[model samples]
Target: MDSRDWGRFLLPYEQAVEELKVKFKTLRTEFKSRDEYTPIEFVTGRIKRISSILEKAKRLNVPMDKLETGIEDIAGIRIMCQFVQDIHRLSALIRARKDMVVVYEKDYITNNKESGYRSYHIIIEYPVQTSLGLKPVLAEIQMRTLAMNFWATIEHSLNYKFKEHLPSDIKVRLQNAAEAAYQLDQEMASIRDEIISAQQHFEDKTHLVSRVLNGIQDLYYYHRIREAAQFQLKFNELWETEDMWQLKELSQELQEALQRAKRSNS
Candidate 1:
């Protein structure tokens, strides 16, 4: 097809990728606000380039008119996780979503490829509303741990650089790197609870510190400069001491002061 035709055909796929990215990003934000354990670390998406799509179609023996049915990943989304378990958790979450229908799944993590690739791929048919009507676009969502993604990214670069005709030494090195990455994921998963607990604690402390600092800054605008300065001093002392209890007490105190300031002004 011509460039104009390709653009028209790809519009719905682009919309599907954007909508899915937003939906997953919103879920991550909601989980953060609720202080819940979110399975998603981050998300990214893209609609394949016209040239790449054409090449892929040619390689797969897909007809121009049959591209829509034959191509599963004209649009792609990648979700990266901190742990291997998160990949399975996110896959289940995607399956439970009502907005998209799961067309098929590939568990490469469990049944890894000969090239030592490990990931979970889900192909979903997402309905995109256009000016004309609803168009169902097929998009592939890949889930992987950070380690696996790192290895896959490097492997992809090597394959592209060598045009898939890698020297034996490089091929062996790539396989070794993949195994090391996989072992890293396994080690991290073994202590997943401890890692998650540490992360949650850090996030909580960060939130508390931000709230306290902002509250103190707001107090200065309310003409409570003296009180604000005093609280700032207390916060500095508590921060240096590394005392969690005092810091929480300071946050409560600052919060109550903010409420009083708002009430008196109202």
Candidate 2:
């Protein structure tokens, strides 16, 4: 296809990728807004290059005229998670969505590739509106843990550098490296609960500290300079102790002080 034809053909696929990325990212934000543990850590999307499309189509024996139905990954979305389990959770959520139809799934995590590549691949048919009409575009969503993604990225680069023919020694090393990455994922999963607890504690303390500081600032805005100074001192003392209870008490004290200051000023 000519450049113009290629651009026109890929436009709907690009739109599908962008929309899927936004939808998955919004899931992460919505989960956090509810103070819940989100399966998705981050999302990324891309459209296959023109050269790549041609190469794959040639390899798959797909006619240029039949590229739309023959190419499943013209548009791709990648979602990364902190734990392996999160990959499954995210995939299940995607399967339940109405905007897209799930075509198939490849569970590479359980049945890893010989090259040691591990990820969950979900093929979906997404509807994108064009000037002509609504177009159904096939897109692939790859879900993996952070470690798996890191390993896969390096492996991809190496494969490209070697033109899919790495030296035997380097291939051995890459396999070993993949195993190490998988081990890291397993270790992290084992302590996932503990890690999550610590993270939640930090988040809670951060919000509490913010509320206390805002209260002090409100007091200063009310012309209660003395009260604000006192609040600052108390916060400093509690912060140094690193005691959550003391910080909580300080936050309450500042909130009540701010209310009193407002009443007195009125």
Candidate 3:
């Protein structure tokens, strides 16, 4: 295809990647707001470059005309998790999504590749609305633990540098590194509860601080400088003591105080 045709053809895939990224990021935010553990630590996405697409197409012997159906990974999303088990949780979440339909899945985590690569991949048919109409496109989602992604990233760079023909020593070293990464994930999983609890505590504190700040801002806007200063002083005390519960209670009290002030003024 010409450059113009290629750009036009890639528009839907680009849209799919951007939309999916936003959706998964929203999920993370929702979980944080609820102080719940999220299987997805973070999400990233991209559309395959034209050069990479052409190379893959050539390697796979895919005809240009058949590229749409033949290339399943033109648009890609990577979801990083804190534990191996979270990968399965994310997979289930993806399967249950109404916006995207899962056409196929590969459990590389359960069945690791010979090169020691591991991840869970799902191919989904996502529909994008355009000026013309709704266009259904194929996108790939890869889910893996943070360690697994770290290993895969290094391995991928090596593969590219060596043109997939790595020296024996380097190949062996990469395989060993992959195993070490897997073991690291296992160790993290063993202490998963502690890790999650720590994260939840942090999120709770952050949310409380945000609420307190917003309340203070509202008080200042209503010309309640004294009340706002008092609340700020209490906030500083609770923050210095690291008292999350007390801070939360203060937030609520401030809210009530502001409401009463509003009512009295009204």
**Candidate 2 wrongly placed segments (more than 4 Å):** 261-266
Give the root-mean-square deviation of each candidate in angstroms.
1.0, 1.5, 2.0
lDDT of 3 by residue, 76-103 (tens): 9999998998998888988999999999
List runs of model 1 lying over 4 Å from the truth.
none
Per TM-score, the best of the predicted structures is 1
The C-alpha lDDT values of all candidates are 0.92, 0.91, 0.92
Between candidates 1 and 2, name the one with more favorable TM-score: 1
Residue 83, candidate 3: how far off, in angstroms? 1.6
User: Can you write out model 1's per-residue Cα lDDT over 60-109, one digit (the tens) per residue?
Assistant: 99998998999999999999999999988888888999999999999999
Count clashing pairs, candidate 2. 0
Candidate 2 structure quality by residue, lDDT tens digits, 152-213: 99999999999999999988888898899999999999999999999889889888989988
Q: Which ten residues in a row have the lowest lDDT in candidate 3?
A: 199-208
